[model samples]
Target: MVYDLNISAGELRASAGAADTLVTDLRPVLKKAVDDLTAASSSLRHWTAGPRMAETGEGWGGALGALRDNLTEHARGLRLLANGRDIMEQEVLSSFKGW
Candidate 1:
């Protein structure tokens, strides 16, 4: 059985653009939150206040930081995919351009 994904390159481009814009808008706020989390984690560690609690804070901070990084990577991938679609479409339509 052959299956078509029913995906549209134009839609991909639009979605990617929207994602990029949203991420750009949220960057500063997210960064500040991550920074605050890390700082709190560091403070907890310095005070030697309950090893488990400090560790948990550090873990949460790390996870949040990783999440931010993943979002960046996802955005990059989306743009790349969108651009790839455009390139492929251009190549496919090249023959008709002269007419």
Candidate 2:
């Protein structure tokens, strides 16, 4: 197995910036989707369902809620990765003192 790693400070910064932008752009959309799903789930309580159908609706709502939570967490992780890269860039610059 062979591994080739090549990355400059400017590239790191640019990639980090792009990641930050992506996280910023997606977070709000994900948040709104979560909110909408929660609202819809709440409204589902008003609908009349048969014994089996009611259980199905409950399961569906739970799945939506879980998906929303996962998306929210994913956004958070993306932001963290971007920020960590930025921090690492700073640390490298400080260590070199010539960059």
Candidate 3:
């Protein structure tokens, strides 16, 4: 039995690039959303549910932060994988130089 494995470094790099672009584009939007939520919560301070709204906003901000961090790490991992694959491929090709 033989198993074939194929990995495309270019595709992995492209995916990483896309993730990076998404994070870049999303950063400002996430910040604005959190800021808006905080502002809204502040404006409702006199209401009975003001504190609850603030708490909910905080939770959402935290979740968004976590999502951003996870995506960054994913992009980093993809880049590392692509680099490692590239290095391995170079090494393998060089091994055949004498043949």
Candidate 4:
């Protein structure tokens, strides 16, 4: 899963004084949030909304709960990513002086 985020690593690494700090600060939170979302999405896959859905009734409820948790975490993760992006945009991609 972490491998998939490689596309944005340049942006994430741009501001860090040391490469490890970037991983330290960002990886844990991002990992958990993504994992939660994945679990939620996976749970939802087994849900059947119509009658005779009993075959997966527990999964349906679990899916909803997982989705709820994922939604909440997703919002927070987005904010962190935005803040990190802003840091990269301002510190790494800019001269920190006006044009």
Candidate 5:
């Protein structure tokens, strides 16, 4: 394989930037999901749960759905980061002479 160090370096840098961007975007979403889950869990834990059962159930369901979606997004973001890291790593290894 023909390995051009200059192009590989640029690509690796770009991919690393993309990974950082993905992490930046994912963190807030994960945090919001955690916040929603915490709030829902707290409401359940502190319940006079019977009186507000229907309302609380509905709210909890919505929060859980939001959390689920956020988790999905996090998974996707993680995959992206993994792919970027893999590319960067391959570029690095390819640039080296003997490995």
Candidate 6:
């Protein structure tokens, strides 16, 4: 059985661009959320649940940071894949040029 793999470098690059944009857009929003959470928790410091709230905010911030990092890595991987695909396609075409 012959199997064909169809890959579009343009689409891969586009997806990578989209991921990059998402990360960029999320940065400020994430920062604002973390800052707000921290401030809110500080205001509640006199309450019994203040420390817990702070901890929860920290956890949320860490999770958001991890998500941003993952998205960045994903975009990098996609870009690399697109570059590799373009190279492979070029090599294949060059090989067939003399035929």
Q: What is the C-alpha lDDT of each candidate?
A: 0.71, 0.62, 0.92, 0.54, 0.62, 0.93
lDDT of 5 by residue, 13-97 (tens): 5665665576667667756765665666566766665336546555766765675566556656656666777788889988995
Cα lDDT of model 3 by residue, 1-99, tens digit: 977567699999999999999999999999999998889889999997777789988999999999999999999999999999999989999999899
In angstroms, the error of model 3 at 29 is: 1.1
- Which candidate would rank higher by lDDT, 1 or 6? 6
**Candidate 1, 75: how far from true, in Å?**
0.8
| Clashes (N, CA, C under 3 Å) per candidate | 0, 0, 0, 0, 0, 0
Ranking the candidates on TM-score from highest down gives 6, 3, 1, 2, 5, 4
TM-score for each candidate, following the candidate numbering: 0.59, 0.52, 0.88, 0.36, 0.42, 0.90
Q: Tell how far residue 25 is off in model 2, in angstroms.
A: 12
Give residue 95's lDDT in candidate 4 (0 to 100): 79
TM-score of 5: 0.42
Candidate 2 per-residue lDDT over residues 1-99, each given as its tens digit: 978665554555566556556656766776666566556556675665343455655566567567656655665665666677778989998999975
Per residue, candidate 4 scores C-alpha lDDT tens digits across 1-99 of: 345554363453343324344445555665565555556656665554332343344455566556555555555565577577777877855775666
Tens digit of lDDT per residue, candidate 1, span 1-99? 999876776777677677677767777876676567566766677566645555665676677667667777777787788788788889989968988
Error of 1 at 52 (Å): 2.3
Report the C-alpha displacement of residue 42, candidate 3, in angstroms: 0.7
Q: Which residue pairs show backbone clashes in model 4?
A: none
On the 0 to 100 scale, the lDDT of residue 81 in model 6 is 97
- Clashing residue pairs in candidate 3 are none
What candidate 6 gets wrong by more than 4 Å, as runs, is 1-5
